[model samples]
Target: MSIRLTPLGRMVVPVLVLVGLIGLNGWLSATMGRGPWLDVDKVFHLAIGIVVSWVFYYLLRQKHDAVPHYGFFGAGMMLGASGWFPLVSQGLLFSALPDWDITLFGIGSHRNPAFHSALIPFFLVIGLLHYRGMRDFAIGLSVGVCSHLLVDLCQSASSHPDWYRPNFYPIVRGMYGPFAVLWMLGNALIAAGLAYGAAGRQPALVRMEREGFE
Candidate 1:
């Protein structure tokens, strides 16, 4: 089925993606380094971001326009935006919020809720627009958000010692300096990979298969 984007949906997806890109850029400036933000993390994030979007589009190739192009794009953008929220929020509050005063149940990263909240609505709208019911929407939302969060948690807790700081409550920390830049680079690449996987032709096909089952 040939898919098309509703005008409003078209506008929304790109705008959200652009905003997400901008936020990451700002975060790179603040956290990575002081000199013109020559951090590799930003480069990785941008590259991965594009790759994720492209890969997602690719995987859905069979469904080319099935999910409604803009709808898929919007869903992807929502995840992207949400993925960066924690970093952006922390950057914003880094100086303002005391090290000992930040928690809504002591979640380590700000990115968690920021992305998940936005993701649910994004997928919900995608479902509504496609006249697809709640199942695909929920799956998409859960997969997108949970997948991203799982990566973050894993990176933070295990593989990426340099990317984030290990601490309990009130003071969640991430690394700084060159190593920090590398950490962001790694995370961004991983995010992009997940996005690509979810949004990819295979994933989209899986979604379509699930839809058929329902």
Candidate 2:
């Protein structure tokens, strides 16, 4: 039998799943007596990934004129976005894979130009071109990585207070103080706008409400 959801359900369910995963992570961290599984920077990345993935799903569904399996698609996007843990001989590294460069090179600084560079995502998307039928997954992962870097840049700026043009590295000194906060707020606003637009354009959303997925 096929499963389907109403338009509202399509949107609500994925959000619920995101919330559930975050809650589970928090609970696990508390029970395991561990530091937060993800630091605040990483938590920002996770939130960006979930929001971007959900918006992208609606956009793709609208563009393709296809009724995607919303639940499955949403879950896949979330998984791809947040799947950064890598096992080493010592233990599992909970940070994003790109962050390994800092550890590998023994960079004591939390913000590394190489790892947190904004250019990295552009290259990642270009590299993903070799893999067909995986664009959505790649996009989700790239968004997550990029957002992580952006958050790190903000945090670094916040901590340093005097750093300017810290994001692009050697090319430009990053802005600090109010600038970082504005940058973050701008990103949040863009995401919210895209989500709203996608919701408006989803042709199949209401259909799901009536007929459900088949």
The candidate scoring highest on TM-score is 2
Off by over 4 Å in 2: 1-3, 33-55, 65-95, 127-140, 146-176, 182-214
Compared with the true structure, what per-residue lDDT tens digits does model 1 show for residues 1-214? Answer: 9879775765566657656665665566568653332433324333334434444544456455544245545453434323333333333222111111234434455433333233343445445432343333332433344334333343344434443433322111444434443443444444434433434333455566678843
lDDT of each: 0.40, 0.46
Candidate 2, 1-214: lDDT as tens digits:
9888878888787678756655665565466533444343344446656666665556566555643344433433343333344222121255564465555665454334444443444454455433323433344444455445444554455456555544423211243445544554454344334333433433554455457552
lDDT of 2: 0.46
Q: What TM-score number comes out for model 1?
A: 0.33
| Clash pairs for candidate 1 | 3-65, 56-199, 56-200, 59-200, 59-201, 60-201, 82-115, 86-110, 86-111, 165-173
**Any runs in candidate 1 off by more than 4 Å, and if so which?**
1-31, 34-46, 63-67, 70-79, 82-127, 130-147, 150-154, 157-214
